[model samples]
Target: MGKPTGFMEYDRKDNKAVEPLERIKNFNEFHTPMSDKDRATQAARCMNCGVPFCQSGMMINGMASGCPLNNLVPEWNDLLFHGNLEKALQMLRQTNNFPEFTSRVCPALCEAACTCGLNGEPVSCKANENAIIEYGYANGLMKAKPPKVRTGKKVAIVGSGPSGLAAADQLNKRGHDVTVYERNDHIGGLLMYGIPNMKLEKWVIDRKQKVMEEEGIHFIVNTNVGKDVKAETLLKEYDSVILCCGASHPRDIKAPGREAQGIYFAVDFLTRSTKHVLTGKKEGWVDTKGKNVVVIGGGDTGNDCVGTAVRQGAKSVVQIEMMPKLPDQRAANNPWPEWPRVCKTDYGQEEAIAVYGKDPRIYQATVKEFIADKNGVLKKVKLVKLEPKKDPKTGRMNMTEIQGSEFELPADYVLIAAGFLGTEDYIAKAFKVKLNARTNVETKPGKYQTSVDKIFTAGDMHRGQSLVVWGINEGRHVAREVDEKLMGYTNLP
Candidate 1:
């Protein structure tokens, strides 16, 4: 440890956020980076535990406790504390392929599992990581280093999300020719469309894309794999095909007035908003200005919708959650080093509160029906309160709706932020890969190979809908497996 008493001496100080009202005015990243000296002090708070749970990346109670990529938290913290910026950057890059994206959007699982968080605040691992990576970018430490020799074997990655990108990066480093196919007009799949510009700016993705291009990786956008480009062609042309298409089939709320005109899937809404932001075109945008909006499903996507609506000058916003509000503090069943189950006010909710008079989230409630006008345009919504009840057979708690507890809200625009189902069927069927019960491409337990020979799968397609960090983890493992299969032996880490 650089300073043994640093944890005791320094209190955790996070990067300052722009005021909610001010930040909602524009869709830009709002957090101000701390100075180098201040960030080093925060880094010094790392206790360098004997067993660093921050990097364990294990499953406890069915939730990920640490970073899925197994980022070296303590080593980099100590290096950062000692002012070794280049060394810290190298250490950060050893495991994680993209710290810039994760630092901004990741929920900071490493911090949740930190040893210092047992009694007090956790070390600012995420911020320190951001500092290290940004330092590398600013000082020209991050540059393309293409392999000197070529393996001549070509690999095809079928998606451009985090997992697909990471797999492409690793395979290209091993001298294998890599080509990535993206259905969207841009390279990043979810990163380009699913996420809002406030959390992760498009420029960050473009920056990385530039570096990957310089490293000899080929990218083909505006091409859907199953429909536009046949899977048979890829199988014949490339030595190995890796499917990284994400779990994109959205879960829908089945209710009356479902055919309303103003109703939209959360992914489609976010995608349109991002498209408008990037292209500066508003021809098909879902404009919510001066309209009352209601977002369904209390998740990250819902929060993004709330934030987006606020920025677009929505007259009002309401976020509906089926589950009851969690305790303000961790419950007794929850302990240190485990993912805390507590109430968290995200940026979107904060913006909503600032614009509206009160918090927008209505916990323990669900939409019963979508009330529409005569012309089939969404006008209002009927919501019903929920109560937790145990199932008689399984003894599992279920949110049962309470009769006679229905209410109505003025909702001109209804955004369904409910989560996604498994991978879209067209891509899976086109590849002819077997799907497990969850609808994700079935591989041998803990393996990346698909049912078809010379075909591999990773990320949401292999697993399920998950965090960006886990996607990267899946990508790295799949690359290693594909490399071994191609060369009969592998040196990839």
Candidate 2:
């Protein structure tokens, strides 16, 4: 450890955020980064525990406890504290393929399990990670380093999301000829479109893509693997085919008037907005300006919808969640070193509160049905309050709507952000891969291989929709498996 008593000396400090009211006017990142010295002080608080659980990546009480990538947290923190910026970057890159992405978006499971946080504020590990990566980029430490020799093996990776990109990066570094195929016109599957620009700018993705291209990995955009390019063609042409296609099958709202003109899936809404922002065009766009917006499902996606709507000058915004709100502090059941199941106010919710004078979220409530206008455009939604009760047969908790509690609210646009079911059936069918009961690609337990020979799967497609960090972790693991299978040995970490 750089300083044994550093934790006692320094108080936790994080990046400054732009004021919610001011930040909502533009779709850029709202965080103001801390200075290098301050970041080093933050890193110095790592503690370097005798048994550091920060990188354990353990599943405790059905939730993740630490970094799933098993990132070398202590090592990098020590390096940063010692003012070895390059070494810190090296240690960070050893595990995470994209720290920049995770630092900005990841919930920071590492911080949740931090020893310091057991009683006090945790070290700013996430911010330190972001600082290290951004420093590397600024100092030109991150550059194209193409493999000197080719392995004469061709690998095809479908989907250019986090998992696919990670796999492609790993395989390309191993001197294998790798090509990534993306269905969208641009690379970065969800990162480019599903996420709002305010959280992660498109130029960041573009910059990484440029570096990957310079490193000899080829990217083919606007090419749907199963449709535009036949699955049979990839099977025949490539030595191995890795499917990192994300689980994009959106879960739908099955109430009456679901087919209304103004209702849209959250992904579709976000994609449209990002595309409009990138292209600077309004033709065929879903406008929320001066509209009463109702967002269903109270997760990150729903919050993103709220932020986006507010940015577009929405008249009113309401986010409905079927589940009850969590406690502000950790409950008795959730203890230290376990991922805390507590209420969190994300960036979008803060902006919503600032704009609407109250939190946009309506907990313990759900939309019962949609009321539409004569032209089939959505106008109002019938919402019902719910109560949690034990089911007689299953003995499991379930939500039931309360009697005489239904109410209606005007709604000009409805966005369903209730999460995804699994991967779309078409992609699974195209590859002739078996799907699990959950509709996810069925790979061997603790393995990335699918039922079909020469076919492997990773990320949301294989594991169901999950965190981006998990996608990157699986991608790296799948690449190691593919490398070992092809060359009889692999040096990939």
Candidate 3:
């Protein structure tokens, strides 16, 4: 409660985004952070409610209500409001390992559950976080501090994504020699390639990697654990092994003409786009210039594809979504302190509308078939409308195709972003760990240890495909559990 009437006096303000048409020229982060004074005003708007659902991190109606990391939202906001930026940075980093990554990528569940948003707009917690972190970097407040003593216990983390990085950071802080193995040519598995440069520039990840390395965290990239390097060797060498390899398997769209050329998975497309952006190489690039693109599965990855295609000078873009459109406002069944179920026009769709004069999303529709030419090159897409229907036995709503509502659109390229199934089987097989019904690594209820001794898991590999925040959460928890099992007690927060 920096100011009693702060919420009333100051309205919520967010970072300004670059206009769509102009920003489509390059794959750079577009939003410009506000001044320090404006950020303080935004931080002042935090009422710091008695309960503060903004940090509850609870699940209601199967959706996250607040930040899964349980970030100290109110304390940091108050500190920022009072211009205590050094203290604010400390408070922000207490729970989050990488604010720079989450500030730009996270959907801001904290703001959605903010008390101020009950009747009006929510506080700009995400923007404030970005400001605090960027300030730390600019002012040289963020630096590497390696542990003074080593515990003589070496731990191996099998991924370089958020979860693996967070776990490595924590264990390294506790005097354990931590080694992270990334399969890709660079560290930051999903952060490096899976995400586009427009949202999170690669330099941010590189900067964090530099700091983590200075903190005595060894990184081994361009060497896969299950393939190039044997899992048995790591298990034999390291005292404990933590598998943070993400759910690398992408869900596929099985339709007629599925084997046609120009049809690619969303992850592969995005990875290629990012690699080309970073290296200026064309070996694996999927050029979309002058092409008509169709993206299946209207999710974040799909939106990234839309934006990427637009930047590559695509003549047209269409996003096919199987589910119906959400309402503009929250429905009556939905209430405050819960994740809102409302339609959101993301950056990519906004760009599509700005360029094409219409929203690119086709709600309640799916790909019936991929219509290709004789040479197996994708030329058009057959789309069919869908309607919600309830199953008689299961009593669950399902999207069924609508009769006689098929349509066709010119599509030279098709990107499937239908989400992921689970962790890849090779790594699981390498470790000989059991998988659950959902294909995620199985463990005891509410635990991170796997069936094999001295073996544990976290992040998308342990839980399933999820946000970076959830991955970091699982990483911190698994580190604590692993620390306890090794040292007979734990001091990690």
lDDT of each: 0.95, 0.93, 0.93
Model 1 bad stretches (over 4 Å): none
Model 2 lDDT on a 0 to 1 scale: 0.93
Residue pairs clashing in model 2 are none
My TM-score estimates for the predictions, one after another, are 0.99, 0.99, 0.99
Model 2 Cα lDDT, one tens digit per residue, 166-224: 99999999999999999999998888898899988988899899899999999999998
Q: Cα lDDT of model 3 overall? A: 0.93
Worst 10-residue lDDT window, candidate 3: 4-13
Q: Write the per-residue lDDT of candidate 3 for residues 279-319, one digit (tens) a residue.
A: 99999899999999999988899999999999999999999
User: Where in model 2 is the C-alpha error above 4 Å?
Assistant: none
